[model samples]
Target chain A: EPEVTQTPSHQVTQMGQEVILRCVPISNHLYFYWYRQILGQKVEFLVSFYNNEISEKSEIFDDQFSVERPDGSNFTLKIRSTKLEDSAMYFCASNAETQYFGPGTRLLVL
Target chain B: EDKVVQSPLSLVVHEGDTVTLNCSYEVTNFRSLLWYKQEKKAPTFLFMLTSSGIEKKSGRLSSILDKKELSSILNITATQTGDSAIYLCAVAGGGSQGNLIFGKGTKLSVKP
Candidate 1:
């Protein structure tokens, strides 16, 4: 079965540096989403993208965060300046009516 | 604030045992409730419920929605140790986004 794929299964970065998490959602899906799971916490939605633009976002998705589908098959999330709290497992998902998730990129900020 | 709550954070059962996991939610413009199973990786979809009273079944697992009580329950009968995992309940709000709000989940451990 086709599944969403994410790059850099585990990423370690310095505080205040920039990092980009990459995902390739299932082809033919129209909607994409980004979510994070803080250690020992529930997963929280960051943003949702549809039709080449952001359709919805949560409070946690602020100026420092941005998502873009630079081209077909690639969805990326960038953080301008990382913070310790930004450390979490970031999951990228796609929906063609039913949603499917990627294995996730575990981001660790030092 | 909209929230999803699951009960009995964790449980342990033996093979062939029957178990029920609970989920309750409060969200604006509720559309559908869904269940997923998570092991070590991302969650895998299980069932989606849109209306109350209709039961969705897949093999040994089944789920039902009770909109009147704003809750749902997942039942796993004749459970196997492989059934051990975290069960997540999420709600899809009515709109184009279909952005889901998920509960923390119930962790189940099935022993031999």
Candidate 2:
């Protein structure tokens, strides 16, 4: 089965540096989403994208966060300034009816 | 805020045991409830329940939604050691975007 794929399975960055997490959602799906899981915490929604724009975002997705579909296949999340609290497992997902998730990118901001 | 609560945060069982995981939610414009299995990295999709009373099943796992009670349950029969994982329950609602609100998850450990 076709699944969502994400690049840089694990990323480590300095606290003030910028990092972009990339995802290639299932080719035919129209809705794309980003979610994060703090170690041992529940998965939290970050943002959702559709029709080439952000549909919704959570408080955690503040000024430092931005998402873009730079190309037809790539959905990317950019964090302008990483923080220690920003360390988490970020998952990209896509859906028509049921959402399918990628293997996830573990971001470690130190 | 939309909320999802899962009961009995951890469960331990032996092979061939049957386990039932519970999830309850409070959200407006509820669309669907989903179950996922998380081993180490990502959460793998298990089942999606949309209507009340109707059950969705795959192999030894089955799930049912109770819209009236705003709850759902996932049942695993004849569980195996491979079934040891964190089971997450998420609900989608309130907008067109369909972003999910997740519960803390129930961790299941099946021993040999």
Q: Among these predicted structures, which one has the highest lDDT?
A: 2
Mind sharing the TM-score for model 1?
0.97
Question: Which digits, one per residue and each the tens of the lDDT, describe model 1 over residues B1-112?
Answer: 8889998799999999999999999998998898999898798899999999999999999999999999999999999989999999999884459888999999999999
What DockQ do the predictions score, one after another? 0.77, 0.91
Task: Show where candidate 1 strays beyond 4 Å.
Answer: B94-96
**Which prediction has the highest TM-score against the true structure?**
2
Q: Superposing all C-alpha atoms, what RMSD in Å does each candidate have to the true structure?
A: 1.0, 0.6
lDDT (Cα, tens digit) per residue for candidate 2, span A34-58: 9999998999999999999999999
Q: What range of 10 consecutive residues in model 1 chain B has the weakest lDDT sum? A: B91-100
lDDT (Cα, tens digit) per residue for candidate 1, span A30-92: 999999988788888889999999999999999999999999989999999999999999999
DockQ of 1: 0.77
